[model samples]
Target chain A: MHIAFDPRLRVAGPLQALDARCKVLAFFALVACAASVPAPSWRAPVAFLGAATLLLLVSRIPLGAALRRLLFLVPVVLALAAVVPFAKAAGGEKVALWTGGPMVPRQGLLVLWNVSSKALVGLLCAIILAGTTGVPRLLEAFERLCVPRVLVLTMSFIHRYAITMQEELARMKRARDARGWRGRWIWQAGTLGSMAGTLFLRSYERGERVWQAMLARGYRGKLIGPSSAPLRLLDVMFVVWMLAAGLAIRFLVR
Target chain B: MTAPAIRVSALTFRYPDGTRALDDVSLEVAPGERVALLGANGAGKSTLLLSLNGLCDPGGRVEIGGTPVGSRNLPEIRRRVGLVFQNPDDQLFCPTLFDDVAFGPRNLGLGEEEVQKRVHEALHRVDLATLEEKPSFHLSYGQKKRAALATVLSMQPEVLALDEPTSALHPRARREMIALLRTLSCALVVATHDLEMARELCPRAVVMARGRIVATGETSVVLADTKAMDEAELL
Candidate 1:
């Protein structure tokens, strides 16, 4: 199965028009604000979700694609949220589990709602940002934002090669299937583990070869790039508007 | 005009698990010589190429321009020898084609203007000038290979070491690569089983098998030696 982020989402057009640093900071700030509000307050989450939806609509990305990406996180959040009510007692006071008592807490449902909504909103913001910006532009933006060069370099390589690794995995799976080695769930797990091991080794070898190639070109442990386009006044204005709207929602709306 | 550009003497190597990869190999190439290393699979051709740039340890018996391969001379040696790996995906690790081509020059601490100049020149050399801003992954295989070549060429190395440079290239792309390599003045060492390519592009040929050099001479004679070619599995 392909695990790579879609490339079509990264093509330059409407999304490329906006500065990457602005989008990253804005998304991050929104996520932090979304996470900080108490779970019991539904109004904050509703406001955050509404803001994210508005941004998505204005960005001109297809609504279906955005929702599809957001949907990927639903199962995980739901699984984590499922156990909340059963784990805690409903009343403020806890009672023995084996004894006859209403052990589940009423606040547990509120906590679950809070966690799920925050996670969904946070994920939505991230998806929108990633969908708009290509990986290289995003890395360049991070570098401009003063992110450590090593981290930027690492993420850049990861984004470039993740698809290659996925292709390698697909090839291995095809080879295994050709050998007629179909099996049950546990056997499949074993096969997957071996595939993971092989992928790791191959990636490690590729890493060495890439480094050697780098050295051949006079690489000295530091990454360098061309002079990027300077942030325009419009990019600054975009950031100001996003921050203002976010702050207005958080502090003023209440 | 001076010493041979590359010198290898009694070069031997073994992997960590003790599998001998190269054995008692000795050779030399003068400046501007285009040499093809012809071998079948598992012939240790790549191992030898890697040794030229200090990517592989040769147990202390390899030299470039009369200077022995060592930690002290490695950076200088690497700057002089551009090694293009078989896979473009592995070689072009940077996110964008521009960054990948500029990587080597940037690492050399060149100014941003110089880096851009080299990147443009290298891309122009490989006929990839229009793809400066494209991501590496989005390019077709032929384009990726050309970009990979540009990545190394930007460094302007005196010696170019290529491993399977045309293995998966289309016919047109292969022709383009051979033409490009011919126009370059640097000493070229290409390791491949493509006898046709060797016949067309290189004046000299080396036959390798099981980590040993079986024959080396004028490309036509060495490649025409049926018995030696058979023994080395090149034929």
Candidate 2:
């Protein structure tokens, strides 16, 4: 299966000029604030949704594209939400699904709304952050936050070449299809396995040659990139604003 | 006289699966020399190139400027020998062209300012200064190759080894690469099946066949060996 993460979704334009670490930290803080509030507290969800909407407007990302990208998770969210009412605890309060016996509780419906709202808010925040910032900048921020170099490098490589690998697979599939291959499920399964095996072997060999190239250029087990730009005063202000807003919503409102 | 830039004697290598890739290969490259290694497919040209940087340890004699290729000298040897693989994708693994070019210098523990300086100079050398911030995957094949070259050149290697340097370049790109190589002072050893490239870029040529050296001499004379080329099925 092909994994598609659109690089264009990464932050671009003026917002991209803001520090990446600030955006990442702000995202996590907002998610925490959104997730912790009780189901009865509709104010938290409203506040979170407002913030997300503001971010989308300011970041200049099309709302339609953001929703479309997030739509892939809708089925899974709905399925999980479907089960919430049954397992939810309520004091003898029963809710009917279709004019029959109790399939849910009143509290369970509230919990379902709570879960769905929190998930959407969190997902939207992430989508905005990812859509605005470039992958390299994000990695730089991650490294600054002390993420392991190897992990960052691995993720970057996967992001860069995963598309190329997918294209290779598509070409192989086409080649197989062109060779008088019938539409038999069993034969297709065998061909698919062979194609996967071939792709793995090719990737392994490519990794070897890449490593050798690294060695030839005096690599000695350390990954180094350009000197990261210092965190700007405005970036610090952004972080402070996020923290203040979150604390106000959490403590002041409660 | 000074030791040859690269020296290999009776070099033989077999894969872990027992496939013989190089068999008793021997060659010498002098300093400030540009030599082209010519061989058909499966003739062990790539294996020999890898041995030059100790990337393929065949347990045979390999010396760079009289220093043996071993674990103790690997870092030093690597600093002196730059090998550009056949595929630029393999060489340009970093996200940005600047980082890829600066990777070698940074690995050498140079200061940040020094690394930046070297990266700029190397990119300038390859005419890729404007592409520093561009992602490698977005680059054209010619630009990727140039970036790969800059990656190695940032390390200031004394000898450059390239595998099939002109296999997939357009005519203009090929000419640009040849001209760039000619302008550089470092010794170069290129392994390729492109005899026309050999004639244009190298002063010396070595013909390999089935993991053995078939002929070596001045580029024109060795390439003129019609009998040998006919026998090796390369003519």
Q: What is the TM-score of chain B alone in each candidate?
A: 0.98, 0.97
RMSD of 1: 4.6
Candidate 2 residue runs with Cα over 4 Å from true position:
A1-15, A61-65, A89-103, A148-157, A160-164, A173-194, A252-254, B111-117
Q: Report the CA-based lDDT of candidate 1 relative to the real structure.
A: 0.80
Chain A TM-score across all models, in listed order: 0.81, 0.78
Residue pairs with clashing backbones, model 1: A89-A103, A89-A104, A89-A105, A90-A104, A90-A105, A90-A106
Each model's DockQ? 0.54, 0.60
Which pairs clash in model 2? Answer: A9-A131, A10-A131, A10-A132, A10-A133, A11-A131, A11-A132, A11-A133
For every candidate, C-alpha RMSD to the true structure in Å: 4.6, 3.6
Candidate 1 lDDT over residue span A1-254, tens digit each: 11125654554455458788887887787777778776557677788889888877776666777777777887887797668765665357444445686555656766777788888888777777877875656776888889998998788667656766766777788999999878767757788888889998887777677667767676665455555667888887777777777777777554
Tell me the lDDT of model 2 at B33: 94
Cα TM-score per model:
0.83, 0.85
Model 2 over residues A1-254: C-alpha lDDT tens digits?
21124533444565667788888888778788878878766667777778778877888776778878778769967897768876766475776867876567887877777788888888887777777765656776777888898998787667646644654677677998899777587757887788899987777677676777877877775555556678899888877877777767765664
TM-score top scorer:
2
**True-structure Cα RMSD, model 2:** 3.6
